[model samples]
Target: MQPTTPLFLQKFSSNAPESKELQRLTSFENVENKNRDTYLDMIRIFINRNHVYRRGHVEFIYSALKNMESFGVQKDLEVYKALIDVLPKGKFIPTNVFQAEFMHYPKQQQCVIDLLEQMEDNGVMPDYEMEDLLSNIFGNRGFPLRKYWRMMYWMPKFKNSSPWPVPSPLPDNIYELAKYAIQRISSVDVQSQITVYQTKEIESSIDDTWIVSAQAPSQKDLLKNHDLKEPVYVEGSFRIWVKDQLVNYFVLKRQPKQHIKTIKDDLDDVSNIRTPIFSFQKPIEKQVQVMQSVHEQEDGVILAVCATGTSTKDSLLSWIRHLEKDGNPVLSDALVVFTLRTGTREVATVNNVEQKQIESK
Candidate 1:
């Protein structure tokens, strides 16, 4: 949108506020600090610069949405509403039924829809104020408004449905993250306790990292009862996500418990009152109903779950040693095998100069 002039003046002033491309580049440069305040400031500047015609609001909004994660404000409710507020009021609302059904100002409508989608993906719940704002901008029947309505209907219902409550904006520290992951995985037992161990304590340890481990009292007893002849496993690098962050965890597991699944009769059937007409049918057999803990499910029983700071074989060895040092002394005599997907179990340990490694069989 630069006027006819010598190229020097165009480069000198750049007239950033007058041109969307220049303004976007200049605004991106100005946001060097890269935090929430600086992010909101850039949005305010864009709004002020193009307040009259708002010529490039769609493009600017798109650019802002793209940079939200870098500024650490993607899940911020206030930030999203601020982006929605950029569109001029009372302008894009469709007048006729036809205008509402077919996309009016398709590009702009699509842009707002994308913004709401980002919000939804980041789990940002919209408020009534945002609904009013959307109503003013695109009326009741706009496509984005429909998305907003759908979000309103479903998001709240699902927000608190999870039995395990994890904090919003998950912690950056890997230890704290490991605690959350272990706790979630260990929820099968109410008495499960989380213990933090230091690999440095193990004199011959090489990795020198921390381990956050979770184990229940019953699991400890199970380990105690396990036969020393059968080698239990130190397994995994299994991943679970905390928001956008991926955390890999390991588990100490044993062979699956051998048992037959008994098929039960339909307790709801009330044909017991029938007389000689059904005498030939087999009578209902009743026996003791023993409830088994979910831990005894078909797959291998998870004895313990831990997330190590360094996901190496040596660190896992330290984890096993720490468990033995704790109440589970049986692990010292029991054969604990490494079954990991990340890398080989062949690892060297250092006391000072002499190192020992477990060669893969």
Candidate 2:
């Protein structure tokens, strides 16, 4: 009924070539997909180029810094600062990530510290989390955390600030990282200068002071060794109560004497045991005492004489290795033996140690 259409036009219309519908189809599917791919590629490029968020990227930066060290410390520091600028804060990353990326080698850690110290000296305050992260990383070796914490305590900075955030669950790889790091740190004889600020408003109203008795040697004889019987007084507005004698003895043992040969030639090398005892409240005081006890009782040698759980045994061996790294001959010597505990045992004899080792094997 209609006028006859041209053959070419008829075929084009029937096949939907270059028609409104065909145009719509192309716009909806192919064009959209291509745009999405373009955006995704761009994002990938940004992340890869930044270098801080990615481990490989940061490691490469570290490598470059190491190679540049011969040029100058300032040059290396600049590289580190430039790299740190890209990494955003508050991101959840495993502790091992930092160790792997930034601290795997000793030179890398030293470079980072130098860079951070430089930044700090430049009057540009860094992100608090960065400082906390570094302190946690380098602190155990006794280099900076104690000093940093004490300094922070006195200064207006970090007073109103929230407590440093540590990851709730530690990652698995950090065990080996921490093991080696702790061992390396143990080798240095480090001391921290703690400046505590105390107010009378905080102490409990209760006046209960517990007196702990000594067993063999009485208080008078022990008094010659920085008398534990006397209440340890401090510059701060707080009273110290020596609740446990054993714990007090352990702590006081480290204090330097005038005539007796000191563990460290300088008197300043020793920590002020009086500070923790005088400043802390009850529960924290107890914790400090326990730490003191552990510090005192930890002998250099560990023998795998008895069969314990695999994890426990491995931990002991690791501790022994750490002691060896610290230059403790007792841990290194083959003469030191591990002994199983017996009923009413005072000290485990060398024979007992050998017998126990054989039985465990």
- Using lDDT as the measure, which candidate wins? 1
- For candidate 2, list the clashing residue pairs, or say none: none
Q: Highest TM-score: give the candidate number.
A: 1
Candidate 1 lDDT (Cα, 0 to 1): 0.80
RMSD of 1: 6.5
Which residue ranges in model 1 land beyond 4 Å of their true spot? 1-21, 24-31, 50-52, 260-293, 346-361
lDDT of 1 by residue, 1-361 (tens): 8657445234424244466654654365456788998777667666655355577788888888888888889889999999899899889889999999997778888999999999989899999999998999999989989989999999999999988778876777988888888888888899999999999998878998999999999888888888877878887889987667789999888887676545466768787565768577776666664555556557787789999998988898888888888898887677677767744553222212233346555
Tens digits of lDDT, candidate 2, 74-166: 323333344444333333322465544443445435555554555344323344554555444454332333434444444446433533222
Q: After superposition, how far is residue 144 of candidate 2 from its true place, in Å?
A: 7.3
**Model 1 lDDT-worst window of ten:** 346-355
lDDT, residue 91, model 2: 38
Q: Can you give the lDDT of residue 285 in candidate 2?
A: 22
